[model samples]
Target chain A: MDFDIKRLGFTLLGLLIVLNWGLLMSSIMRKLGARVAKRYGIRWFQPWLDLVKNYALRSQISHGIMFYLGPVFRIGGGVGLFLFMPMIIGSELWLNYSFHGDLVLLMYFQFFGMLGMALGSGEGGHPYSAIGISRGLSQFTTIEVPMTLAIISLAIQYDTLSLIDIVKAQQGGFQNWTMWTNPVATIAGMFSLLGALSHSPFNLVKAPNEIPIGPPTEYHSTFLGVLQTNAAILHVVEAALFMNLFFGGATNWFEFILKTFFIYFWSVFVGVVFPRFRIEQSVAWFLKIPLVFGVLAIILYM
Target chain B: MSETKNNNKFENPHYAKREVTGPDGKQFIVDPIKDYFSDERPKVYEPNSIPVVEKFLNWARAESLWVLGFGTGCGSIEIPPLMTPRFDAFRFGIQSRPTPRQSNVFIISGYLAVKTLKRVIRSYEQMPSPKYVLALGSCTINGGMYFDSYNTINRLDHYIPVDVYVAGCMPRPEALLAAFNRLKELIKEGKGEKANEYAANFDWYKENQKKIIKDWNMPDYNW
Candidate 1:
């Protein structure tokens, strides 16, 4: 396997852009929530300040090797997932490393960071960390059912696992997008996306008193800063993944930003008005209507 | 032992001293005094090499002071109003964070009993670097009415470095906000970098801490 230095450089550039803009996106979402409560929220650069302070901390503690590597795994997963996909089409430079694999590989890499985090947090020796991961992974499996079914439906309908080909198929018109043609799959995918994003009603991983900020409880200083950056990028990348798969892939940066924000807000809107549910409730809720929608989506594709 | 007996340095015979086997197989007793007083010390603080970057960091750190949300004492009651529309603490980038790992400020809201002090020390130590401790009531400064009480510690600084002390039985929300303003000033000037001071004076602080905390079942450091 030959390596292209230019492609690698562009990949890094793309990751940096995503991570930087990702913080701004999150702060905007936070401001939106604060406005709903009639309060002036933090400035857009506030998250950046927090990140700097965390990194500039005078001291830090480590539980062990695995505990140290948890955030490393998390950031790795975020960057890896983005690099595997085609960011822009119709040009070789924009293809990323898509020639190396297909959506099947991208699908598998989705679990890479999460599984690493689970293993790393388990090593941190905090009961809350363990409990959080246990709840998170359990809730994680239920949501995967609908999302997986939706993806399978898309791949089957398009007759390809290559994301470039999939994106190309939807070009030339708005109505050709999977979101319009396969509304059932889009609903199922977005509903499952809510759980994937860990918004309210499915945020049992961050239960009020049960877990002290969940899996990241033991992480501090630069370790946490790394995780925060990764989280920001990962959220945007996850939203972008849906945009490409459902809405038509962006022809330019403006379209990319608009679609990703719209997809992200769909989950945020659901989170705002709903009260939280128990882990069991979230799992059962997914298994019911969302899972039915998933099966229906597959049947519709057939 | 005789010379320091009046200074209250008598070792309690009831508690067995902990012994550890070093990595090279040398067995040694764990003595806080001996470990603390030894001439040599382990280096911990990184050199503040870049003045421009350091200045910027201090300002940023000052700006985003995420107070640990848990109230350690009665002063905790004043915290809610600070968040309400009337006070709005978030406007200054000062908000309550749920976890100790993420928080930069720990507001010891009121008096600290011997029992609670142990937990406070543990929580305070668990907080990441550049952490600030603000004692909210007179009780934390000198135990106030609990000054003569057997269960409370009079001077909070004896156990950990305190950055600010807001005087009141239970200060009002406005007082708390004023204290935050003072804290922000200290942080802005880069004068309140006491986390490293606490680490540098670890033995002295632990000696003072163990003086009152009789049942010290926890490890040497909370981490």
Candidate 2:
């Protein structure tokens, strides 16, 4: 089947990079806030966290339409990825579009999910919701710069933007999945994962104690119910994306699920171990250190 | 007797004769004399539509009163317990609705903030017809805590028509219950004539609502 590479590229890019990555990152940061509060013997933050996690729990019937629509948009974006991402091990017949998967495409598509969430939050019309959106956007802005540099360096190293080509270029052994290819690139990848998950030391968007549930303060009823579901599913998507990019696509379906979940647990473990960062501190830290890793990788490639 | 026997035999097969029984364990023969005087006679099918009495009762039952949660001051804090597990005001057909569209009673809990007064007035206006304003806590009655302040509406009656005034800086829960009982009694007594009068004068109420909203520099309506 003849595939318009640009259209397919944009679609896949929109799904993985735009939609899933943004939500996965923000949700992890939000979950981290709840976890940290529980660990500190602070029960007061429970209601606050519940408020974020269950934004649509108590929504009025009049506003139910909007609340319900938010999650549909979110889940739809996630499902869109399954159709768009190219199958490496499976037959190409399953894919209507065949092209080398561009690393840049993956990065841009990651923001689609974030856009959906921000729009949903905006519709809820709560001050805290707006605040969360602003903070989340700020964090995205800070980390994305270094994340792009790292991806570009990987693309340059393989001399191709297609993710499939990048993985095929490293086909000799398991260590060839790019992380073990260079230590600096690996550190940059790990830090980028940290950024994508919005793990602690970078999770300023949904801070409970300060923001009173942040963007989800006013959401209730089915609206909140869907957001929780979106959060869980989006986690798997993020892990899958990370695994697909850094580790080669699995040879089998079982291995694919397993590898993605392993990455998810690793990300969660990192989230659990760290404390949160203030907006300025998060920006400063990601840019100064992890950014250096990306630069070094690029220089090494050159 | 021979003619009657012939008539019975000639009767149409389409007609079936039904036997009647009595509580006395005997078959009841239709004797005209006994049947004419029987109290167990079928009711005459006069248009026995819904009775006025029953209709009135049903209307009263369905006109379930709802209270608005427009608490103004310290007394506002006490409303949670009255609403929740301990008091459970929902049993009385009086549940709290945040907006006025569904509420009948605007229970002004206490001292109305200048800011809050504007909101209260708007809420009262937004409430559909047959609405009553209940000024709880003495602050709403005569501005108990803040009588001197020009910003405070000393007499709630001056701003919006109030039906009941419950006294105390913070009226005890019992006092609120008593006031609620009185409201129910007033409802039962059909003293809603005043509520109807206020609702009819929509322009005057709207003007007052606008004045409050304008004073606060908020829009006349949230929309």
Candidate 3:
């Protein structure tokens, strides 16, 4: 009902923890992947990661600066998203707020963090970094429409632009969660998340086998450490946000974390198993599915 | 943390020793560990009464020029096998990096066409100090093929001073090795500064690089 600065600060701190958690998870995932590669004698994977790390993080000062800046901008965008969208912290009386400005705001705001990273990488003056940024921006064009459709679906379901109101309306748990109620929309969201995370099958941005970890290739030192940390943290944030939107928040903190982790694990598992999609295929795939879902969500809501 | 952990677990198997057919074609055990431990840890060069052999070794180590993967010409293709197991340039402490930031050597492999020449200059400028350049072929030394094309610069050394010029349309890999040895010799004789002085004409190099890119209306790789 009321915005408290202290409460908001606490929430921001929790957000920081979530970001750090994402950074750690990404590192763990890479390490785990490398270890598996080593066991299988797939020698290239570990060395590949090491080379990228050295090129991007261990090389010099300029790269170091860009690497650290990546996460800060990412967190900034996350903060902005959390501020605008619906979030329900189930502490009985802790807080609940939702406001919808416009679909444009939510959609374009996502680009800020990504764009900042691209710019930072470009300034490092590495060809690979430039190549990566170009690929990343191009991928955006493909996923944006489908994701927008999903957003529109939610917008229609509540007949209001505010995300908080949507969550409040969908409070009846599993049956009320958008995915269960509207499977098409839920599936569309999953596909979009796949694109957003740059996960396997859609992982064009950091495709090691191709672009040599792209923009981060020139980053080094404390800067790269920060970027890597932020990457994992952003993953956690994205996963949590997805869970909050589509799956009911747990009645307790334990349940909440467990449910979120459950989703996170599934996402990671699916992500690791799938091979990366070519840029064109990813674009075409997202364009069709989410657009259809968007039309369906609109019709169903109407 | 993960890098260190993995680095510790993995012993750079690429650098490990195994049985290899010697020049006599007889199988001989080559133990890198034995070779590593057999010698006293090689120290950095000190301008003192170090033994001649030790001095030579240090000079070799210092000029063990690791190249960056900023390929600018047809000559760039030669780099792959040079670093592969057969050639194993790493024996000289020279490794190929994918980024220019970390490399101490810019092997301007061959002719710098107006198109790729801009990138070559940018890469050259990005490399840290105490760097050396090896003009790999006649094209890199004096634009052998495209000498009158106006698209290729006739003398790269006029732009970025070369320490050793390996002559050939495309110099054989052996020539590259020879050029490297020559660079080591020059370094031993305190001629490393000569390369740096030539490279230090930042203004002239920038102008020449700009003319190459602009006169030919060449597009950057991504652009």
Candidate 4:
């Protein structure tokens, strides 16, 4: 709806920044993850190279139309999320298409990709893919509990359903940021963020060697390339959403990079320290721990 | 139950199929086999990999090899140490992947038993195109210590198109790394592409594989 002809150029520019920054952040995070294990890690551009290799692959098969469209939906969901949010404050270029949508839209839109991936993986006909989808959805429903509560708390506190307003309300000083004022909500959201990113502890869905990458076990070549490209953008956009809602939002590109990187690193840090959780273990933990914090944060807001 | 049946036949009658009686008192032939590990020309993806673009693609493929951590034999022992801090395979962007769909490289780690060889072929074929096979250990070359054994296959390359061979009973992590570096060079130089070669010679490889692996339960093409 914010697709003004004059502002289309700015929208494209914003998408490029998100895309580039997304991959850059992941590579950096991967290299950092390598350092914890005392390894040199991959080159800074490994993610890009991986994407290139997938795209360059010659042969691929299709299970059906949904199998073909799974990656498409995955990318679309990520792109839509990034486009709907304002990445930087006080700039026309960074505003993106945030004007026409509210925070509720952003929250609901996140599921489009997940649902698409589930259908796509279902169409893939790999039993492993189905297992992955079940693990993912089950874990996701619990993950949503904390994240939703945090959002509701913030909405009630700010009296607005728009992320722009929430960020604007937290402006003027670091102390006014939601992270400081609503520690309970911030903590709850941060825990859910780790699960959302599928780090080590909550990475049960992918289940590395057991299920073999879960949802996209059948995807090869360009299909994998599309899913990976979407991942690059999705990772950073998800972090930026946290930054906007919790870390007071970024005032400039430099701050955007710095704040979002550290925000993302928080989960990676936890991933390195902890081994994977069983699907049930994570589901139980989210409900037991973060769920308490989330409810407490909401009650505190009231 | 089906596996026990095959092993029983392989041990006793020593033939793939046998004549059995039907419940209605009629004799019938049961050929438990269908698809031949044949020399038929299998379809290729036909990369149309342009010269300039091929170079770039090759470089990318070499740099980001997701090795299928399949240990069909004893050589898998050497692979773990490669991932350890001392060798650090991750530094080269080389990590053992869990699935064939996401992986580009298959490391046949040691002497291949006929049973494991069956699975190895299945997994190798499952991988996407532009893939590489790195045969580790003398066993993969000439069956190593298991050369005299009846269950184990003698040569690895006979069953699959091998791009690189790391020689030794169990090549150390350093040699594994060196072999990987060589494989990377081959990949970048466009020599690491053995997937197409395997496709072109699918029948020959299958013929060799079937010679030792008697129970042909799988389809012609794994994917």
- Could you tell which candidate, 1 or 2, scores higher by DockQ? 1
What lDDT tens digits, residue by residue, belong to model 1 across residues B172-215? 98898888889999988878778888888889988999899887
What are the models' TM-scores?
0.90, 0.49, 0.53, 0.90
Enumerate residue pairs that collide in model 4.
B38-B203, B39-B203, B139-B144
Q: Go through the candidates in order and give each one's C-alpha lDDT.
A: 0.82, 0.60, 0.61, 0.85
lDDT: which is higher, 1 or 3?
1
The digit string of per-residue lDDT tens for model 2 on A192-290 reads: 777776645565675544565566655443455456556655565666666666777666556665676567656667767877877778878888998
- Model 1 per-residue lDDT tens digits across residues A1-302: 67879988888887877887788888888787777767787777888988888888877767679988889998888888888777776767766787778888877777788788898889877788888888888888998899999999998899998888889999989999998988999999989999988877788786545567788887888988999898888988888888889988888777778887888887778888797888899999999988999999999889
**lDDT for position B220 in model 2:** 31
Docking class of 3: incorrect
Candidate 4 is scored at a TM of 0.90
Tens digit of per-residue lDDT, candidate 3, span A1-302: 56677767756666665654554455455444534444222222222233233332212344356555765676566655545443345452223222435435656667877887886887766688898888888887777777777777777766766545555666765788877877777777777787887777787777654776676776543455456555555566566666766776545555555655666666566676777778788778777877777667667777
Listing candidates in order, what is each one's chain A TM-score?
Answer: 0.96, 0.73, 0.79, 0.97
Q: What lDDT tens digits, residue by residue, belong to model 4 across residues A148-225? A: 999999999999999899999999989999999889999999999998888899987876665677887888889989
Clash list (residue pairs), candidate 1: none
Comparing 3 with 4 on DockQ, the higher-scoring candidate is 4
Off by over 4 Å in 1: A207-210, B1-47
